[model samples]
Target: MLNFLKKNIALAWAKRHVSQTENFKNNAEKLQEELLLSLVKTAEKTLFGRSHQFEDIKTIKEFQDKVKINDYEDLKPYIEKVKRGQRSILWPETPEYFAKTSGTTSGSKYIPISKEGMPFQVKGAQSALFHYIAKKNNADFVNGKMIFLQGSPELEEVFGIKTGRLSGIVAHHIPNYLQKNRLPSWETNLIEDWETKVDKIVEETEHENMTLISGIPPWLVMYFEKLTEKHSKKIKQLFPNLQLIVTGGVNYEPYKDKMEFLLGGKVDIVQTFPASEGFFAFQDDYTKDGLLLLTNHGIFYEFIPLEQYGKPDTERLTLKDVELNKDYALILTTNSGLWAYSIGDVVRFTDKNPHRILVSGRTKHFTSAFGEHVIAFEVEEALKSTVLKYPAKITEFHLAPRVNAESELPYHEWFIEFEEEPANLNLFKEELDFQLRNRNSYYDDLISGNILQQLKISKLRKNAFNEYAKSQGKLGGQNKIPRLANDRKLADLLEIYKL
Candidate 1:
């Protein structure tokens, strides 16, 4: 009875919170303008501010003119100063925490979470649940055990400020009300080895009335696999009460069929778009295809059209200026002291009134070896299209251009690890190729012009991608397989795992 009452209270609060967003969405432009000015004014006296003249950022256009789009390399110096305990380097007051993330060149990058900015990160996640609860008119999941497969919550200090992976950092902030319902004991969560931690998690919650599970799709698939294996039963058979799943980090299309098959019953799905930088958006309606972009989340957003991304004097458009369906590289100026930061992700707006979006691809993660410029969204959708007809289950996959195929024409090489291999591999490949061509005209032109061969698929052994990630010291915890690479580095590395 108490649990039921608690759920009703949560539902009421969620409905209210969701209702509040209607006004924010209606006045998003005005709100975003105010947010940017507020951020600039707060940081104006800081080191980066003083240099960039943030005090003169009285208008949005002026702010953009003063602060050029900046990548991580551009802000490294100021970040290093913050790491060494410099006060007011980027924003007033030292950051309360630094979210550590793996970097390609910098080894590790520490993103600040100001005392003020941290709530938005926490609330963004909460609001996602609120959206779900309000839309579905149910919060019964709040009464059951919920688990978020994530990084270890243990923290290390960087100059007296706590530092850890974004997931780990967020784990510490799970609300007091939800504490009892949250699963995986603190000791198990502290286990660093993802393989070992998953085992412990399975043992701890296999019999619980697990109603909600949240994590990236790949890792959640891993957990579900382990759970089903241990109990020798499907998810529905094991946890009959399980009702909700929240997933993020990657597109759910490729894994959707497999995940549903594993579940073996009906369960509501919620998608989210979160990063170390911030929680950007989440699925507002179960019926909608895209996530509702958080306009009031203390992050001012800018979009650079993908075609003009790398060129000099690129145009940056705000939400008011963006068009539907066209891909744009996302940029952000945040209260966390990240100014004009290039977030590297590409997004396509799906709606204008409520400003919903789909994460299309990464700015850097693409295959343009033959000038086709195939993005992650294209490849994932292609595979999804094929899977719908072929009926195969994918564990994971990666795409790379095989430029130096000695005996064959240079082609896109897809290394796919399938949970269940299709009976007709050749037909599946052809369909996938066809789907890709349909989605990307450039790829079709290249194939027709004899510049490239039809793309090739290299089947991978079960758990090949998992093992590869483990070998690379990135088996889990926000590490995702490279969906597309222009070069052969990842392709060469994955060659040995091919079946």
Candidate 2:
């Protein structure tokens, strides 16, 4: 019965709302007004009148002017208010769930997600599913059991509510009705604690014919590797009808080839850009280049020119005014009671009306050593091309800058775990170095002496990084193996790169 509902409800919504969905492409002004109205209404009730994060800004423009541009740093005050159990700033009463996100340190962010926000997540996730079904015209496979690799609670209290991170909060919303109807008999609790659920999730997902899978790229990669090691043939044997594999949370380019290898064949893949703040976008179809924003749902959109958003000067733009194909940083006013919130991801629209955008990278993940700026996506592309040249099976890797004191050039060090041992590791480095330079000429020029000198490869024991993450209490559901690090600080725990 639930499978019947899962298959039919989404299609019914799409059919009845075909014209509305079409409005996504035809009318940008109408879409923006609807979103703005939702934002202002939610804001008036939650902020201005209630929440303290926003005060004294009676009009939308005034609120936009006074709030300033925000990153996570800007959210601290609001989070603290929530921590103090003050309902005066955002919403009334304690939010039911908090989504946790980890940064470089143990300073995990606890973003409050209300019950109101849950519907957006549910529907946002559904968009990826429905889009796939609509494109493939395959409702049979859509009715199958799905697996979501998710984080467990690290601590019981976050933002003054008994909460964890967004992944766990999302886990809580997996409707009981769906669980009863769709989950296989083979599921297990991967999250033993908040810090140690990644490994346990890998252990649990093996051999299951995962019809649908969603999680961060890092965690999915680790899970795929483990699944391939023990149950590679079994994966195809058991899940012959497997239809879709969805992943997000980080850039997907680095692992795309390897993910295809792990699944034993090509499978429909959908990428999503979702933060603890709100549902941003989902891949429009299996073949589209960008994600379609959930324009009429969840949150209202605002874009500050990427340059202007962080700058002290320029004003932000509303959905109606954003330029096409230009980079912009997003500020959101959400139904979850977060107002004029800066979620800190950078996005660019590929299409104007239907509102398709590519998530370029995070604001923090850029590399600027020697002023040879390389974004995470660039680094990911370089690594993918580099890895493709070698016969070695790259189990895992972390890329970081190693500054040479004598020459002043910053070389790249790749700490990799390989299945096949290579005779001369320097060969791997030379090829990788060549590719990096070709991809980014600045990377090439810097390599002679004043730039990067060489690329270094370090081999790790199988699952060594996974074991290390387990030690740090990060093993289990949805924790990804750290693929790249900007600095050498975390390198000491990882295996050293060989010349």
Candidate 3:
């Protein structure tokens, strides 16, 4: 009864929050200006501010003209100073801690998390849940335990500032009042070995009233498999109250059917766009076509057209200026003192009034070796359609272009680890190639002109991806496999397991 009452109160608060968010959305342009002014005023006293002459910035146009778009490489020097315990380098005071993430091209990164910015990160996630509950009217889900499968909360001092994976940092700071409703225990969560930690989580939550589960889809699939194995029944049978599955980190379309089958029953699926930089967007409507951007959050957003991305003196557009269905690389100026920082993700606007968007792909994750430019969104769509048409299930896969100097044509090389192998592998390959060609006009043109050969598929040993991730020290918790690579680096890595 107490838990029910608590859920009702929380639901009421969430509804109110959503109502306020709607107001902000309606007046987004005004809110955005206010947010920009506040950020500029606050950051004007920091070292970066003094160097960039933030005091001279009184308008949005001035702010943009003064600050250039920056990648991680540009901030490394300032971040190094912060790492050495320097005060007022970026933020007004020293950062409370740094959130570490595995870089796509570089080794690793330490993103500063200031005291003021921490709440924004936390609020972004909470707002997502609030929007979910408001849309579905499923407050009862909060009556049971919510298991967020994430990394260990253990922290290491990086030159006096505490640092760890962003999820770990967030997990460590979950609100005290709500701590009892979450799992696994701090001790269980701190276990470094993923297999062991999952075992502990299964043991702890197997008998509990688990209403909601949130994690990357692959990890959740692994956990659900273990639960079903232990109980000799599906997840729906073990946890009768399970209501929702929230996932992010990787595209879920490829894993949707497999996850639903493991669950034993249909459940609400919420997609989120969270990264080490910030919690950006979440599924707001039941259709799930796109995520509604959190406008009133402590972040200002800009978009650079994908075609103009690397060019000198490229134009940047704000939310008011973006057009629907055009891909743009996302840039953020946050209250955390990151000014005009490119977050490396690309997105396309789907709705103008509400400012909803679909994540297209990473800025660096595309292939155009033979004029057949392919993005992750197209690849995922093609794979999803092909899988539905076939009888196979994929455990993991990677796509890369294979160029043979001696050969007249280069071809796409696909490394696939299958959960259920197709009865006719050749037919499966043909259908996949057909789907890709249909989805990407450039690919179709190239194939018709004989500029590129049909894609080649190589079967991989079971757990090939897991083994590869382990070798790279990114076995679990928010780390993801790059689905598309421009070169043969990933292909060469998977070659060892080819059958």
- Span of ten consecutive residues with least summed lDDT in model 1: 475-484
Worst 10 contiguous positions by lDDT, candidate 2: 181-190
TM-score of each: 0.98, 0.82, 0.96
Candidate 1 CA-lDDT value? 0.90
Backbone clashes under 3 angstroms, per model: 0, 24, 0
Overall local distance difference test of candidate 3 = 0.86
Q: Distance (Å) between predicted and true CA of 281, model 1?
A: 0.4
lDDT of 2 by residue, 317-343 (tens): 876677776667777877766666677
1-499, model 1: which lDDT tens digit per residue? 8988989999999999988889887988889999899999998899999999988889999999999999899999999999999899998989889999888877888999998889988899999999889988998998899998889899999999999988989999999988988988999989999999999999999889999999999888889999888878999999999999999998887778879888999999999999888889999977888898998988999999999998989998998999999999999998889999998999999998889999999998999989999998888888888888998888888899888889878998899888888889999999999999999999999999988999889999988988888999998886888788988888888999988
Best candidate according to lDDT? 1
Q: Considering every candidate listed, which one attains the maximal TM-score?
A: 1
Candidate 1 local lDDT, residue 358: 96
Ranking by TM-score: 1, 3, 2
Give stretches of model 3 more than 4 Å off: 405-408
Q: Over 4 Å off in model 2, which ranges?
A: 1-19, 28-30, 45-62, 92-94, 103-106, 153-160, 184-187, 190-210, 231-234, 304-309, 314-328, 387-392, 419-431, 438-449, 477-486, 495-499
Q: What C-alpha lDDT, on a 0 to 100 scale, does residue 376 get in candidate 1? A: 86
